[model samples]
Target chain A: GPKVLQIPSHQIIDMGQMVTLNCDPVSNHLYFYWYKQILGQQMEFLVNFYNGKVMEKSKLFKDQFSVERPDGSYFTLKIQPTALEDSAVYFCASSLGDKNTLYFGAGTRLSVL
Target chain B: GQQVKQSSPSLTVQEGGISILNCDYENDMFDYFAWYKKYPDNSPTLLISVRSNVDKREDGRLTVFLNKSGKHFSLHITASQPEDTAVYLCAAGARNNNAPRFGAGTKLSVKP
Candidate 1:
């Protein structure tokens, strides 16, 4: 079965530090997305990417956040000068197309203290 | 606006019993609805999906029923097992090319 893989199952960082989360989407997938789930809260969409550009982004996607699919190798989300409220489970998902079902990675847990 | 709401924050069922989870959405333009299961410390995995053109979709012990007019959907798990215990999230996509809006999720526990 096709699968999405995320690196660093867990990460802890200081409030002012920077962190980059990486995702390896399914080879044939054309659309990639990022979602965040705060403890005990619903999963919320962060952004969507396709054709090497951002398709849509939610208000939750802050200025400190950036996403890129450089060289078609890995899709990554980088947060600079992270804040305590940034702590959450970040999920990476991929789909064959915009409307197809998304397959998700195990998730990267980020904790900022 | 896109919003998906799930009912029954939590549920417990006997090993051989059935479990039902329901969801509702406010977006009338949504054309795709899906259910996902998530285990602790893991991302959600797609369980099943239904398009507005169809009312029911089933796979193995899991089934999804959609009511387009009411903007509601339900997932039914038959003969539940302990392994079926997990958080279930319902999501709806506005169009074929849009991102999905997910519900808070339902936590189900199948006891032995």
Candidate 2:
């Protein structure tokens, strides 16, 4: 089974600091997605990227958040100024296409103090 | 508004017993439903899925039942084990299938 790998399994940062989360999706996957899960809450969709452009984003994707896939490299999520509420486990997933099943990474646990 | 709702925040079952988790969707346009299992400190893993066109799908000890008429689905785990204890989430894809809406998740505990 294919797997998505997330870098820095755990990160602790001070509030107002910048943080970057990295994800390496399955080699052949075409659609990539980011999801956030707050403590004891459901997983919330953040954004989806394909063809080097954002396909869709949810309201939770705040203005400080940005995503990029530079030169076929890893997909990254950057928060300019992290907030306390931003502390959560961020998961990266990829699928062959809209109709294919998604594969998830182990997730990056971001803790903002 | 919540598009998907899972019943029972937590449940406990004895080993070798059956564990049933239920989920409901308010969006009639959602045609795809999936179940995922998540262990502490780990990302979710896809367990099973069902489309609106199907009534039931089974894989070994795991079974997924879909009731399109009621806009609901359920997952049954037979012969539960301690390893099966985890948070289970149910998600549904809208007609377009671009994003999936997830339920809050149900925590299952299988006692020895």
Candidate 3:
């Protein structure tokens, strides 16, 4: 099975600070996605990127959040001036196509104190 | 306003029995539905999926039944094993959108 790798399995940052989560998707996957999940809650969709552009985003994807996968390198999600509510486990996923099955990484837990 | 909803928070089943998980959705435009399984400290993995074009899909011990009229779907795991214990999430996606909505997930415990 193909695997997606997420860096920094755990991170603790002060509120109002910038934090970036990295993901290495499958080599041939074209569609990338980011999801957030708080403890004991459902996983919420954040955003999806494809072909160097954002294909779609949920309301939870605040203006402070941004995603990029420049030059086919590690896909990154950056949150600037993080808020207390931004603390959650962020999971990165990718698929060969929009309708294909998504492969997910273990996840990066970000705690904004 | 949850577009996809899983009412059951948790369920326990005896090993070798059937495990059924249910989900309902409010979106009519959703044409694709999938089930994902997750263990603690792990990300959700795709278990099974079905398109609106089909009412049911089966692979090995897993089966997904979709009722478009009712806007509902379910995952059935037959001959459940203890290792099958995990959180199951149901997700739905519309053809025109890239983001898929997910349910809260049902934590299943297969008792041996």
Candidate 4:
């Protein structure tokens, strides 16, 4: 099975600081996605990127949050001036296309204190 | 409001029995439905999926039954094993939609 690897499995950052989480998606995957889960709650959609652009984003994707995959490298999620509410496990996923099944990473748990 | 809902927070089933997980949705426009399984400290993995055009689909021991009129779908795992214990999450995707909405998830415990 193809795997999506997330770097820095756990991170603790101070509130108002900037934090970036990295995700290495499958080699041939075209569509990338980010999801957030807090505690034992449902996984909430954050944003999806394709062709180096944001295809769609949910309300949970605040203005402070941004995503980019520079030169087909790691897909990175940067939270500028992180907030306490932003503390959650962020999972990165990728698929051949929007209609295809996704391959997910273990997730990067971010804790903003 | 939650577009997709899984009412049961958890369920217990005996091994070799059937494990049925239910899900309900509020959207009629959704054409694709899927089920994902996840273990603790791991990401959810796709278990099975079905499009609106089909009412039921089966693969091995897993079966997905879709009821459009009821806006509900279910996953039935027959001959369930202890290894089948995991959290099950349901998701619905609309046509041309970029992302799918997910349910709160139901944790299943298969007792040996």
How far is each candidate from the true structure, as Cα RMSD in Å? 1.8, 1.8, 1.0, 1.0
DockQ, candidate 3, vs. native dimer = 0.79
True contacts kept of each: 0.78, 0.68, 0.80, 0.80
lDDT-superior candidate, 1 or 3:
3
Q: Which portions of model 4 show Cα errors greater than 4 Å? A: none
A1-99, model 3: which lDDT tens digit per residue?
A: 999999999999999999999999999999999999998788899999999999999899999999999899999999998999999999999999888
The TM-scores of all predictions, comma-separated, are 0.92, 0.91, 0.97, 0.97
Docking verdict class for candidate 4: medium
Evaluated with DockQ, which candidate comes out highest? 4
lDDT of 1 by residue, B1-112 (tens): 3389986799999999999999999988999999999898777888998888999999999899999989899999999999999999999987746798899999999999
Q: Is 1 or 2 the stronger prediction by lDDT?
A: 1
Whole-model alpha-carbon lDDT for candidate 4: 0.94
- Per-residue alpha-carbon lDDT of model 4 for B1-112, expressed as tens digits? 6899999999999999999999999988899999999998888899999999999999999999999999999999999999999999999988764588899999999999
Name every residue pair that clashes in candidate 1. Answer: none
Residue A108 lDDT in candidate 3: 96
Tens digits of per-residue lDDT, candidate 1, A7-91, equal 9989999999999999999999999999998998888999999999998888999999999999999999999979999999999
